[model samples]
Target chain A: MKPIQLQLKQISYSYNGEKQVLKNVNLDISQGEKIAILGANGAGKSTLFTCMNGVITPDSGEIVIEGKKITKKNKIELTKKVAFVFQQPDNQIIAPTVLSEISFGAMNLKLPQEQVLKRVYEAMEYMNLKTFENRTTHTLSGGEKKRVTIADSIVMQPHIYLFDEPTTALDPLHQQMLEEVLEKLSQQGKTILLSTHDVDFAYRFAQRVIVFYKGEIIADDTAETVFCNNKVLSMSNLKQPILLQIQHILMQKGLLKQCNIFAKNIQQFQKLI
Target chain B: MEKHFEQIDYFAYHSPFRKYSAMSKFIFTMTLLLLCLYFNNIAISCYIIVTMLLINVLKNNIKLYDYIVMLSIPFVFVFFGCIAIAIEIHFENHIIIYVTKQTVLKSICVMARTFGAVSILYFFTLSTPIYQMVFVFQKLHIPKILTELMYITYRYLFILIEIQHQIKIAAISRLGYCDIKTSLKTFSSCIANLFILSLKKAQKHYQAMEARCYTGELLFLQEKQYYNKTTTIKATLYILSILLLKIVLRGQAL
Candidate 1:
């Protein structure tokens, strides 16, 4: 069995203790696992992500990263292991230029300046943001800012990367760009967990799906199985991924019998056609 | 408001001085300003204003008319502020206003100084981006809180402006501002909503920083550049000439 990279035991949190945002949630993430966290607005997805990234300490829970308990003292060290890319690139990007933005996380790790530069360079190359290194961050378009922010996190070279709704405001081209980066990182054996409301994105990209409904994990399973569960979808206030619905409709009409193909994404759908 | 943003963007990104190191430009600005203040000489002050205008028109390629128009906006405000200094008021049987030679001369000196200072600032700001100016602040050993606050403020200023603009658009779209009374209500509500939204945005920004391993100590990428010795030397010589003019050419009654 693979070693657990991250473990959350009976984790719970509430904003100002007014209402329970997270209610006794438990999750175990393994090495190199790709998870898609889906939930409606106010479902505590952001809060849960904060706990996973060590930003928000759970009120009553234990988070163990690679067998070491996450505490305030070691949270800084844990940051080196878990890199979080916030949803709004404008908020997360503090640097004036792209190069500086990418170097920030690595510099925080107390890495040598040269090593920091090296990491930033490689991250820019990975994200194809090398050309924008000299440009001011605010001058960039929305998609470009998203890439720079992603590169900013990638510089840390963390074992586990958390992205909060990265694809939400991105245009189609930039969304495809993000997908390529994620695929490349996944190939590099990095554990990637992203929170998003786009069920189709999760269906096409994530291997495992975790559905959060009012701060509780209502369903967790492989992508195909989770999407096929109508009860889980309704309970979690999530709809089936568009591709799945298309596949189901085609199957019912006996149109896909010739190809026997149920596609997961546009490419798979094209291949089937 | 959108036009204003576009204009600022023009100066920030497209100014010819954007390429020069901010430290050099800032140093020159400081030197010129100090000389103008220390000597309080009319010629040197006039020289400052002229040089600023020349830089904007010739070096930065800004239209002469545009520079004058922008300068005029502040010119009126400063003019009113300096009116008290310019006029000697005597209240006997009736209100009297007189620009006596001494009083007029005093106000002229003050005007020259004010205009000199404003021009030097424009020279620095029109050329150098705000981020680079912040870098210069970092080099000056300014407080982290000050610079970080400045950086965050600079970052959020545009976002807030954008939010206000969007709210205005939405209000107009929904006929929320169709009438004068409704317009007042809509405007007031927009301002109120902006406060709440801005607070939420600030919180999110802090959380994002934390996620990036920020441990309260703010970090930035410093642009690597060596001081242009020639420019520094020329600027030093220029300041010395101005000082020499103040001392050598003084006592010439106008």
Candidate 2:
């Protein structure tokens, strides 16, 4: 089996004193796992991602990365292992210029000037932001800003990438581009963990799905199993993709026996039919 | 044609000025301010203003109207000072006439000097980036604590503006513009809400900063290439000539 990349054992946390946001959460992610965190609003998905990235310290239990227990002393080191792409691109972008913003994280690593420039260029190129290296970040469109934030994290080359609702406000085209980027990253053996309410994107991209409801992991299984289970889907405030729903309707009408619910594009949908 | 002029306005050229060293610009403006205090001659102040106007026109290609509007900000203080002194004079304060003349001239001179100072400072800021400015401050051995505060304040200014915009939208959605009294209450509540939102955002930003391995020190990447030597020399000579003219004009007045 692949080496375990991250393991969260009985992790519990709370923003306020009385109410616990996450309780008894146990998850073990191995290398190259593409996991989608599914939840409704106030389901504590953000808190869980924040805890995983060490932005929030758990009240109890342990977080282990590569067999080493994460503590206050090694939190900085863990940052190198896990990179977080925040929900809003504006919050993460500190530099005035695109080039500087992309290079901001690399500068923290204390790398040499040449190395920093090289990595910045590579990241910008990877995100197709090379043309905008000199542009003011504030002047960029929403999709451009999103791509830059992703590029900023990818430049660090972390083993595990955490995306907090990466495609929340993006248009369909931008969302597709993000999905493609995530697919590429997953193919390169990068452990991808993203929390999103976009069930269609999740079904199309994620190999495994974990559902959260009322601050607890309600279900953790493959995409097909999770989408087909009506009970868990209803409780989590989630529905299958539109095509999947249509396919189910056809089956109920005695038009089809079963359907492949993970069709990502029109071509795939055609083949499925 | 108006669009063209607007494009070439003073604020338009501020982008390049933001790249300059803030410490150098700050010291330069402060020195000019001190000199204006020591020399209370209108001729010298006028000379300085003219020089700044010429620089703005020639180097930055700023329009005359834009330049005048920017230069007029300091005169607001002079206008208020003159009014205060006029009021005192009407109260039959004869013994204070000489003092009032001196004060009035000094205020005018201060305003003129401020115009030049603001122009130069604006040029510096419009040309330089904030990171470069912070780096310059750090290299000057300024206290890291103060520089860090400046950095945070600068970053949060935009964030606060965004929050304010959102609050404005929410207020308007709740029919905040229907009447004056209710509008005031809405405005006050919006302001309060903005403060709370800003505080929460600041906390989240702080956590995010720490997650990115921000260890107290605000680090910036140095420019790979040095500034062009010839351009620096030419700009220095241009500024020195203006200084020389101001000194000569003041000496003639004395």
Candidate 3:
């Protein structure tokens, strides 16, 4: 097996100490795994990602990336390994101009000037943000800002990419584009971990799904298995993807023979029908 | 409450004097202000005002009407100052005493000088971006902490204005404007909420900065090539000659 890129062992956290946000969470993400964290609102999905990225420290237990324990001593070095894209694009974007925003993370690393520009241009090209290099960040549309945030993170070239609800507020076309970008990144052997409420997005993009419920992992399995589990689905407050819902209905009616939920292409679904 | 005013972009134009360094502009404006204060001659002060207007026209491309309105802002003070001086003179009840030529001329001179100093500063602001001005301050060895605070304050001024607009709309929606008493209460609460929200935002922004590995030091990465030596020299020479001519011509009157 490939070495584990990220690990959280018996981790727990509380915002105010009166109420715990995450409890006894043990998660291990291998190299290049496309994992999706799913949960209802206030389920601590965001809190978990924050802990993983070292944005928030757990009240107890340990978060280890690779083999080193994450502590204040190595937090800055650890950040270079885990890049986080915040849920709100507006909050994450601090620079006035697009090129400067993209270069922000790289520049923070104190990289050489030429290397910073090179990575910025490459990230811009990768995120298809070359056109808006000189544009003011405030003037860009929601999708454009989202892309800029992604470009900002990707410029760091971190080993593990953590996105908190990356698809939120994006139009359908942009959502599809985001999924494609994530897929391409996963294929390049980057460990992509994203939190989302959208079950369909997780089904399409994530290979493994971890369901969070009121600060605990309720289910951790392959996407197909997790979605097929009614208990996990209800606990997570997640509906099955539309295709899966249609598949189940057809299966019940004997219109389809098998209840196989994993279908990547429309032709496969059509053939199944 | 129209946020989008017609003259919104009035300050966007780079002031011709802005091309010079902030230190140079500061020195020039302060010297001109001192000269205006020292001389109690209406003719000399008027000459300075005319020179300022001509510079504004040639450098900033300001319209004739806009320049006139800009110059008129201080006349209210001039009016009050002249009236006060006249009243002081009228205590003896002499007809000529209340309206002495010297008193009138002195008030007009004071007003012209005040207007001249304001116009020069206005031109300075019009030409320089607020960020660049802050950078100039930093380069002048001003405390980094103070400069950073000023920079953030300047950038967020527009953002806070937008927030105030939203807060007003929210207040109006809650029937805040239905009565004068309620309106006053709503306005006070809005002000309180604005401060609270700004503080919260500042905290969040600080956290975001920490997340991005921001230390206390502010890092600027403008290319060294952006500062053209020849252009700066030419701009300096142009501003100096005009300033020299104004001082030379005005000194001749003394």
Candidate with top DockQ is 1
Model 2 docking tier (incorrect/acceptable/medium/high):
acceptable
lDDT of 2 at B2: 29
- Which scores higher on DockQ, 1 or 3? 1
How high is the DockQ of candidate 2? 0.40
Which candidate wins on lDDT?
A: 1
Comparing 1 with 3 on TM-score, the higher-scoring candidate is 1
**Stretch of 10 with least lDDT, candidate 1 chain B:** B1-10
Query: lDDT-based ranking, best first?
Result: 1, 2, 3
- lDDT by residue (A139-203, candidate 2, tens digit) is 67889999998988887788899999999889999998998999899989999999999898888
User: TM-score of A-chain in each prediction?
Assistant: 0.95, 0.95, 0.96
lDDT of candidates 1 onward, in order = 0.84, 0.75, 0.75
Better of 2 and 3 by DockQ: 2
lDDT tens digits by residue: candidate 3, B1-254: 12322132234322444445555555556666666666645555666678777776776677777767655656677778766764533445564435676666556666666676676666666555555566668878999999878756654554567678899999899899899999999999999998998887776656555566676665534312144467567556755655565667665543
Question: Residue A71 deviation, candidate 3, in Å?
Answer: 2.0
Error of 1 at A56 (Å): 0.7
Chain B TM-score against the true chain B, candidate 3: 0.75
